[model samples]
Target: MSRYFLIRIGQSLLAIWGIVTIVFVVTRMLGDPAVLLLPLGTPDSQIQELRSSLGLERPMIVQYLDFLRHAAVGDFGLSYQSFRPAMEVVLERMPATAILTASSLALGAVLGAATGFAAALARGRFLEFVVMCLALAGQATPVFWLGILLVLFFAVELGWFPTGGWDGPASLVLPTMALGIFVAANITRLFRSSMIETLSEDYIRTARAKGLMPRTIFMVHAARNALIPVVTMLALLAAELLGGSAVTETVFSWPGVGRLLVQAIDSKDFPVIQAGVFLIATIFVGVNFLVDLLYTLLDPRIRLGR
Candidate 1:
C-alpha cells in the first residue's frame, strides 16, 4: 500500500509539473500582457520598462525557472492587473468556488445515485423509463441555457432566488441546480449500467442462492461491486465541475474562481490566468490521487495486485 501511494504521489507531482509548464508556455504565447496593461499608443521605451519591471525582459527559461521556484513556495508572482500576489487573488475567491463545487457535487452524487439505484431496482418498469428520460434530458440540455432559464423562472418570474451574484444561500440554488443536473445525468447513466452488469455477475447469484436477504444481496454485494467504476467517474467529474463552473459562474455572476478566471482572461491578466489554471490542475491531480486511494479501500484486490 505504501509503495502504491508513493507511486501515485510521484505521478501526481509529475502531472502538476507538466500542467505548470504548459500554463506558462501558453500564457506567454497569448502576447505580452504588459502591452495590454498599458494605455493605447504607449511608447516602446515605456513598454520595455514595464516589461523589464514585470521580468518579461528575462529569458524564457529564466522566467520559467523563477516561476517554478516561487510556485514551490506557494508564490505565483503579482497579478498584472491587481498588482497583488497572484495566488492571493486566487485564494480570495476560492471560498465561493469551494462552496459552489461542494454543493453541486454532493447534490449531483446523491440525486444520481438514488435515481440510478431506483432505475436498476425497477429495471424494465415505468419508474426506470421515467428516470432514464429525465437523465437523458439533463444530459442533452446545455448548462448555460439551463442556468439562464432557471434565472428567468426562479429569479425573474417567481422571484424565489436571486438572478446573479453571491449573497446568501438563496443565491446558490440556481447555479447549483444548473451545474449539478448534468453531473447527475452522467453519473446516473454510468451507475445504472454498472449496476446492471454487477447484478448479472455470478457472485450476485451466489449471494441470492445463499438465501441472503434481497436487500443485502443488492446493497452489499451488487452495489459495492458496481461502485468501483462510479468512484473513478466521480473523481473525473470533480475536475469537470471545477472547469465547468466557469460557465455557470459567468451566467450567475458568482464571485468564485471560475468568474475570476473569466475576468482575468478577458483582461489578458497573464499572472492570474496562470495561477488559476495551475490551481485547477492541482485540484484535478489531488482528486485523482484520493480516488486511487479509495480504489484500494473499496476493493482489497487492487492493493494486493499493486
Candidate 2:
C-alpha cells in the first residue's frame, strides 16, 4: 500500500509539472504582457522598458526557468493587473469557491443518491420514469443557462434568493442549485445503473432468498456494494465542479477563484491566470490521487500492489 501511494504521488507530481509547463507556455502565447499592462497608445520604448522591468525581455527559456524557480518556492509572482502576489489573490477568493463547490457537491450527492435509489426500487413504475426524465433534462441543461433562469425566478420574480454575489447564505442558494442540479442529474444516472446491476447480483438474490427485510437487503447489501462506483463518480464530479465553476461563478458574480480567473483572463493578467490554472490543476490531481487511494478501502479486492 505504501508503495502504491508513493507511485501515485510520483504520478501526481509529474502531472502538476506538466500543467505548470502548459500554463506557462499558453499564457505567454496569449500576447506580450507589456502590451496588455500598458495603455493603448503606449510608446514602443516605454513598452520595452516595462517588459524589461517585468523580466519579459529575457529569452523564453530563461523566463520559464525563473517562473518554475519562483513557483517551486511558492511564489507565483506579482499579478500584472493587481500588482499583488498572484497566489495571494487566488487564495483570497479560494474560500468562496470552496464553499460553493462543497455546497453544490453535498446537495447533488444527496439528491442524486436518493432519487436514483428510489428509481431503482420502483423500476418500470411511473415514479421511476418521471425521475429518469428529470435526470435526463437536468443533464441536458447547460449550467450557465440554468443559473440565469434560477436567478430570474428565485431572485428576480420570487425574491427568495439574491440574484448574484456571495454576501450570505441566501446568496448561495441559487448558484448552488444551478450547479448542483446538473451534477445531480449525472450522478442519478450513474447511481441508477450501478444500483440496478448490484440488485441483479447473486449476493443480492441470496440475501432476498434468506428472507432479509427488503430495506435491509437493498440498503445494507445492495446499496453498500453499489456505492463503489458512486464514490468514483463523486470524485470525478469534484474535478468537473472546479472547472465548471468558472462559468457558474461568472454568471452569479460570486467572488470566487473561478470568478477571479475569469477576471484575470479578461484583463490579460498573465501571472494571475497562470497561478489560477496551476492551482486548479493541482487540486484536480490531488483529488484523483485521493480517490485512487479510496478504491482500496472501498473494495478489498482492489489490492494496491497488484
For model 1, residues 152-252, the per-residue Cα lDDT tens digits are 99999999999999778999999999988988998898899999999999888888888999999888888887899989988998876665388899999
lDDT of 2 by residue, 1-306 (tens): 788778888888899899889888988878887888788999999999999999988999999999999888778889988799999999889888888889999999999999999999999999999999999999999999999999899899998998999777999899989989988898898899999999999988898899999999988888887888888888887876664388899999999888888888878788898888888888898888878778787677787769
- Please give each candidate's TM-score: 0.95, 0.96
Off by over 4 Å in 2: none
Question: What lDDT does candidate 1 reach at residue 49?
Answer: 97
Q: After superposition, how far is residue 257 of candidate 1 from its true place, in Å?
A: 0.8
Each model's lDDT comes to: 0.88, 0.88
Top candidate (TM-score): 2
